[model samples]
Target: MLPDQSITEELPKDRKQKRQPHSAYLRRRLMTLTSIIIVSMFALEAAVTAWYDYRAQLANLEKEAYLLADAQRSVLAAAVWNFDFDIINNAVNNLFSMPEIMQVAIRYPDGEVIASAGKLSDGAAQMRITRPLLWDQGGEKEIGTLNVVIDISQVESSMLVKLTERSVTLSATLFICLAAIYLACRWMTQPLEELTAAITRLADGDLEQRIPHTQRNDEIGNVARALVKFSENSRLLYDLQNSLTFNVAEKTRQLKQVREDSAHDNTVRARLLAMVSQEIRSPMTAIQGAVMLCKNGLTGEIQEKTLHMLHVAERNCERMQKLIEVLFDIYQIQNHSLVLTLSPVNLLKLARTQTEIWRNKAYQTSKNLHFESGVAEAWVRGDEKRLQQIIDILLSNAVRHSGKGGEISVHLRREGALISLSVSDNGPGIPKKIRPYLFEGLARSDEACSDSLGSGFSLTLAKGLVELQGGQIYFESIAKEISSNSTLPTGATFYLELPYIPAPEAAD
Candidate 1:
């Protein structure tokens, strides 16, 4: 309802809307999941192909090596039988001509090397094949052994190149798959994203937003349909709430206008009362003077009955004059026309003076009035007249509320940089229901009290005057049970606090 309060209520929604959308999360997860699956499949395929191809190549190379060794066995056998060193050398040299053959050796039947070509080193990447040479075809005649060492490093190098190519292809494939998945996810969730945006706008007070894909027959379209329904409902609800709010606001505005009119009327009445009281007081003052003279025999010798009547007329005039002054003070406070003449005044002296005046009045009412001052002289910055009025109001309330034989206490003390004054009464305390409106003009706890007499305007004027002089007034009350029969003793204490100002130091 309040501007600041409305902003506070809407701030969390604003912050939540500012966060990343669900579509972004969906897109990222889809792309990542797709890429991982594709890459894993490619890696597995590459690994299986490479392993199978390497094993097949190794088997083929072994078979070819055995064939080459068999073919060279006959030549090597005939060469060794003839004891022809040139033939053995030629055969071995021809075997070395094969690039795969790293070494070749023809040995005699007695284990003596007849001929050898190329170097033979023991390395894991080489394949070796050996075959025994036969001299007679029908009979087994041992000649020599043909040994050939083939280099497998070239095969391994070729396989490594193939694997590198596959790796490059796999990487490219993964990139393509990622791009496709991203596009696919974007297409699938695009409607949802739009719906979300529309919802966000609606939540942000844009009730006109609508989902655009409600006609499609898919899951997204189903959601869109539901969202459209929600939007319609929300719009209707918003309209209803808006209408209610407008009505309430209209009523509130009317109520405020009425209150303002009432305040204006009260102000006009106070001004009128001030004017009438002044006019009546002038004549009443003259009448009182004449009556007092008649009672004193200054005009003529008056009878006892006439003198008693004069006395009654003078007292009535005094009461009327006091009521008029109170009305004038209320008018001044209501119009904000009460001006304070601020000066350094001794609050202790002011409290003592008002206490002595109220003490006599309390005594006449059979109420005990006591004053306690913690400090001899407590200086404060305030208007003396306003301060006196505050004390008077508190004392009057205490004496009026406190029953006969009740005790009323006034305490004044200097508390740090402030002066505290309190008036307490051992009588019925303020009722809880009336505490809220206690300081309002013409508001009285006792409804039967005459408006022209104890209208509670004094306390309101006192609070206004105190605040105008940079002071505060408040009260505390406690209800205590006195006996098994009596309900409780309602007692109240009113406190006034004003800034303490020390006297100016004398110049040296």
Candidate 2:
């Protein structure tokens, strides 16, 4: 059997490097990642807790200093008022019992210390607060001032103890989590490793190997169940693969033979069309000339009725000649020999001239034709004769498909590096059934219009000619619905665009 060759290319280049076994990698990767994430989260929490705790300790130091100073200020104020030095000294000395208040002193406003406690070491980091002592028994009067200093250096050490306790607790929790995850990964990967070995053995034509973990209800069990069924169908798949390989080879051979036959048929058909068109053109031209001479009274005097019949015959003969030429062109295109004669041609002029020619034909069918363009010269590099032929096909198709008294219009314009020509008709639009194959070498008719007959590959020829000149052609139409009331225009418009070229004189 042929391998699925694309699988090798579709694998990642990184996968081509030396790699660990899937089972071990799965276990190790899962456990390691889980361990890292748990550790990182715990560490982040510890750091944030330590930061807030440190800030809180410093804030408590400041708040306690103020609180303790406020608590004893009244007693100190009375002591100072009564000129009792011993009571003031005792009140200031009691503040040293609070750990945060490292130093406390009562001083007179003149900077003389009345009483103080807690000696300060030189260059010790501390926070100090000062407040004036006021008498509360009467209107406020400053007797003295109280100052307190708080030790802030020990805040870091206190926070460190808190963070250390949290770290120890988190470390124990993390160890337990990592151990659980490791055990779980081992349990998961063991069965997976067995399944991997089963698949590898199955791939190596060991159809009878056991599939593990089917009794447990999990994805692993589901995989084992599926593998159990796959093992039973292993021989069937092998047989089918051999049959499919044979079928694919047979179908490829048949397809190649069919394409060869189609190419041969196309060649034969093109040659027949060329031979038939050449055979019909000579007699068609003679008949048209004879009809013309008889109508002009050169083949003896003809009656008025005979003259009208001759005109009809002459028109039919002209149409036939056109069909022959169209066939020959189709043959040339099919045989890939439709060579284009490139030159700078004025598209506007060609459209106007063809419109004038088609106007006479339109008038015969009670249809009016109009030509409009803004530019005097719309230049494009193309075969003028082929371009004219494209215009003729578009105009003729418009006139034929339009109802009697319907308006036909030929519009041309130059639009920056491209020239556009459109032929429009206010008739019952192109038929729905044939729209899909409109430009696919199919005969077309607007049966609703009831004023025209359709034959030949006019649209297909127009498409071929337009594309050969480096142009695009398309059409738009909407058929009026029988049951709906709408103001939609039931008409068809054909548009052709060719790459515009600078005028000959402008180029010079």
Candidate 3:
């Protein structure tokens, strides 16, 4: 029933469950702590018990020696009084026969020995108790003394045996208590270790691994139920995320396909328009020539009415030719087959020339054209024709957007390692509704498309051409609704910057 009694009993095979590494480590710590505490208590108790037992054994032996001396004092006194040596020797021998009495002696008061049963031992300690013989029957006169020496060596041997027994019992109890603590720690930590592993699995996205021991009504069970809820939520979120990703990928694929189809359709339409324009151009050119000849009286004299009609025909023919040229240019650019003849061109001269040409055109539209140059000669390497065309587009756009009598300015300047030609107009700034799609070149409204001289892709084509020549183009514009507080201008300023070619490189 006690721990010491059951210490040697073997544990049942079923109760000895295999411990997990975590549980085993925890159990080892618990066992070590329990061992320290229990062993300390055992040591203290054993020391106290041994100390008391040793003292009691020594005291009992000493008490018995004194009592033996007292018992023999009367007889020794009578023997001494009668001068009987035989009785004295017999009593001394009797006292020595007992184990505690190592030696017994009867002696006269002058230290002469009458009788003694034993000599002193070689190493055994002795307690000598002396009792004097008094002949009180006569006049209480002293005759002889009895000396009993107790052998404490016997008490030491007895203490050794008793201490050994106590130590054995306590050691057994300490071991069993430690073993029980170890088992308890292992049992309790097993479920905790399982829960820890389950948490790791869940964190690693192993949502399918079932958490064990959920049915128990304990703290571990509460945690298990909470984990179960978290797992369900995680699974639901994972499913939703997967579904959302699938839908996004599918939508992106559909968008890419649609864009490919649209690009194909645009390519085909550009080719068709180029073909139709080429067909219409020859006849239109011939008609313009014939009308010019008749109006000049080379064929015959013409009335004023016929002359005005011929003038109208010439203007319409020019408009048609310009539209066709724009369409063909758009097609060539779209197919990436547009050829550029690279050369070192004087950018300032080019800007001046284009400004003059557009100045005449702007005059016809009642818009004033102004030109300014910040550098004497700005050189850039590019297709001279394409550069001229880009300037023409910007100038034409300025003229078209400008109100009557609105001032248009063409500025040419050197911008560190580049040459920039900017054209601006003092007209209403770009409209807000088309700002988002402004560069895509869909004018979007009649107000934005006031001049239909260009294809819907004029800005787009200009941007592509600038990039092809290693240049950049950007613009700044305030919509018509906002008033310009700055002194610069109210309309748009489009900048076309090309890599500047040094004069030395140009010469080479």
Against the true structure, whose lDDT is highest? 2
- Candidate 1 lDDT, tens digit per residue, 352-454? 9999999999999899999999987888898888788788889988888788899999999988888999999987666677678778765565622642354
Per-residue lDDT tens digits for candidate 3, residues 1-508, read: 3332232232222124422123444456666786778688878978898889889878887787777777878888888889888988888887888887878888889999888887788888777788889988747988888888888887788788888887888778878876887787788779889999999999999999898877755556656766776676678778889999999999999999999999999988878868977998899889889988988999988999999998988888887887777777777877788899998888888889989988898899788999999898898889989988888878878887888899998888887898888888877787777767766667544665545555346677788789989999988887656765655457889999999877645245
How many Å off is the CA of 505 in candidate 2?
3.1
Candidates in order, TM-scores: namely 0.63, 0.55, 0.67
RMSD of 3: 12.2
Model 2 scores a C-alpha lDDT of 0.81
TM-score of 3: 0.67
Candidate 2: pairs in clash: none
- Model 3 lDDT, residue 504, Cα: 48
- The TM-score-based order of candidates, best leading, equals 3, 1, 2
Q: Whose TM-score is higher: candidate 2's or candidate 3's? A: 3
Off by over 4 Å in 1: 1-62, 66-86, 89-218, 357-367, 396-406, 426-438, 441-455, 476-492, 503-508
TM-score of 2: 0.55
lDDT value for model 3: 0.80
Question: Where is the poorest 10-residue window by lDDT in model 1?
Answer: 446-455
- Over 111-175, each residue of candidate 2 has an lDDT whose tens digit, in order, gives 88988888776766688899899997658988789998887767877787888998898888888
